[model samples]
Target: MANEYYEFFCPVKMVAGFKALEHIPFELSSHDASRPLIITDRGVRGVGLVDIVTKALEAADMQAIDIFDDVPPDSSMITVATIAALYREKECDSILAIGGGSVIDTAKGVNILVSEGGDDLRAYSGTGVVKSPLNPFFVIPTTAGTGSETTNVSVIKDDKTGAKVPFVSPFLLPDAAILDPRMTLSLPPKITAATGMDALTHAVESFTGLAKNPISDAYATAAMKKIVTHLPEVLKNPSDAAGRLQLAEASTMAGIAFSNSMVGMVHSLGHSVGAKCHVPHGLCMSILMPHVLEFNLSVSSENIGELLLHVAGSDVYASTPVAERPAKAIATIIALKEEMYALCELPRKLSETGSVKETDLEDIARMALDDGSMLLNPIDATFEQALSVLKKAF
Candidate 1:
């Protein structure tokens, strides 16, 4: 059979394994980047991971021109601008983003200004707007999820209106991504659970959403199975190096999958809820996953059933009637959610976490409708339908 036409683009050179930090200097040297700017969060600095990376760079005779460690959980545009100004002042030719999605994303945001000389972040919110590549940037992810290291998109929150905006450009993709399990070995149980579930959501959504293709399906299915098996073990023992390695690989695979095919309503709602409530991105994803799976099952039953078989190692479709397969998948997802809650002691409902009112539903739905991810859902959802999903999740 002739190959069908489809676009697959991931230019980042991925370096992964135990002690992956040792290779960062080689990667930077290959790119001719000597004076690099390191972007990370203070929490990561507190853990001493940042110091470890700096030591590695110094040992390789590479100088860190500046280190920006002030990136917050959900980074704002102001933060990006501040870092951009600093990068310009330092005359840094490259960026080293070390930490989770927020830090990497902030680096990407700052890259826009350092490369393009923009003072206003609002000016570069859409896709393919950047004409030139930013600094030769390397991404080192400390979390098992987000996949920001491999993606061409960077999400930043607008402080003025409290909206999370995405900066999409092929140029935003990192020059390299270094995934070391050691970086995530110290992740707290709550973060382990939440981020693992976030990766699972990405896999499931990419497999079942409107953009499903053979390549993405392969990646997503493998990621989902790895996540289901390894997530529990990692939560039970945070220092389980093998389990953490599997999860790191799975999360990277899922990121590649979703970055190519994109996610669905789960992400749409997750983004909206996180932006409005200041909830952790993974926590919102964890709380809303089951309901979103149920909502999409009607249209994506076969694929969802296949995913269930892969995750549970059981052919749910053959055991259940054809008409009941969708329900079986939904039930399986809910069961997994319960398992996650038990493992991590995470809250099941939104209200359990905080004071989210019914009034918030309408706004969340409206915000979701504006999200670019919603356009790729298997079943097109209206604002009212999104509200219903939020209510069910609540």
Candidate 2:
């Protein structure tokens, strides 16, 4: 039976396809923004994507934009303050984020400070604390994972306390997202595979979580279908523009789906593993996803069973016995993992991550039990159950 109620909300406007980057000028202009502070990291800047985007802006008579290319992998309050100061000094009117999760989140943090009129971003750390909309923000993702472009939450690390601070508000979501195939065309094979798994995890967890509803399910399934088909294609042929576009779109859809419906145990443990083991978040998700789904089978069997149609082709879904579809779905996910591992050696177990030891599993499980995502899990796993899943993943 369905839940009594659910809510879905996504205000980010998506402009996708070839030459989508060329549309940024018009998108910013519509928001009355001309001088935008471009936020990116060295990796993206090194790839000369900044030059490509800048040329697009200059073509549209936007030549006075400011660029900040020093954002790090883990953004901090100091980083936010420094970028915010630059935005203020340059008198930038808007933000154009041109990279992945860290870069986009830094842009959002800068927007908060510039709009809310304060340098201490930590003050706004909590849910729904940002009451007013910030400056117009546009995101051009260089990676297809994270879905930070469409999510309403941003996490900035506190340099002094070594704590991850969270900021969440409807206003935090990007006003526009550009999903050009060219943006992801340069991704390495392993990154492409890991990020694709990240998107799949987002869609799957959203579909199986307690808050799922019809709208989120539609988006989740659609995203899963896109990922199942296009992820491997792009991995096999990085130059495939159509496949890249599908993955980019799938990531955004998964973001919208999970942002509304929320995620469950997979994310709970994945976050813990990432924090504890310093593994790539997508790699962590890929390792833990099947295990968590198996753990949730008693409660989420029907939901997991239904995912088979979306993850596998319709022929496989139809031929599988209805009673066994849930287990089949889990097997299919593991098969996808195997395929990815074959292509890129994407780790299929905690042991392969090199950073995670068996001794660390207890701490990861304890941390996962305390994670907020656990609240939305179909089953309220105790520490022992959580540890069991980690052990199985290990």
Candidate 3:
């Protein structure tokens, strides 16, 4: 992370703390965007999150342009188009995404179409493709994971092409990201455990990945320390508003880190495992994080060792031999997973996921070699090595 040439950028305004949702109306007014469409999914609306946001807006005497709450888990280009059409019909001037990854991504896709006047996302499906800025967009993530609120990437499944299309552009960044404890207080124990682990993985991968720089490392390490300290506290008492806020901050910090430094083999293998096995993405990261880190230890040992100071306390890091800190960090991750498994039944093995079978290992490894995230890994993984890692994880 020292003396390296790298790029980092995160322009989205962050509004976090108690009653952060109350600032949404002011943020909208700052962007001169009053008629904003609320994009969400059934899970968020069902949990009364949308109602909470809506009430906040109404308290400010602001009415939303519309509320689209049918966003599917695998949001498609067609969904983006429908939202764009509704945005036009309702004369929406902005977008407020209020859910997890899929909803935020759908909102980004809709902003692309409505702001740029296009029905097909294929026209802007690659890196740096969007030339113009999007509409006044904002996000309020219901879960403290994924960090889609801070990233400049959106993946919309193109049902026409049968591919999960990646729309990468700085223009995809939102005007603001609102974090309030109220948004995540409803998360179940298992979900909290999984998403917390996911954020921790993002920080670890960013700090240890090939593109790490001083700026990203700062965000990544801070994120790791916060997640390590606060995740269990939140799991023990879900009503802990302060802990919920800390977890949210960690997720956003990790998001900022990876958005600049990117991820590595863990995400590569995790993505493949998720695609092939239908395992939840966070659980895939949780199960595979330590294994992938151990594999990368051959080349990333020093950086991995430094992570011990964040994963465990500085006192533990100081007590451990420097030569053994990386191993200690890896052991700390395993212990965290064990605690989560006991607290919330978060699976510690691929087989325990109930979705992945032994036969799926080879296919998962093969798919992982093609994953873009693998390119950033310090180790240039091959099919056999990826398979070896998957088999070990299984």
Q: Model 3, 58: alpha-carbon shift in Å?
A: 0.9
lDDT of 3 by residue, 11-57 (tens): 98999999999999999999998998999998899989999998999
TM-score of 3: 0.98
Off by over 4 Å in 3: 1-3
Show where candidate 1 strays beyond 4 Å: 1-5, 118-123, 158-163, 314-324
Give the Å error, residue 191, model 3: 0.8
lDDT of 1: 0.85
Error of 2 at 172 (Å): 0.5
Residue 5 lDDT, candidate 3, scale 0-100: 85
Q: After superposition, how far is residue 293 of candidate 2 from its true place, in Å?
A: 0.5
Flag clash pairs in model 1: none
Per-residue lDDT for 89-163 in model 1, tens only? 889988999899889888999888888887898899988888687778998888998877778898899999997
Which run of 10 residues does model 2 get worst, by summed lDDT? 57-66
Candidate 2 on 303-328: residue-level lDDT in tens?
99999999998999999999999999
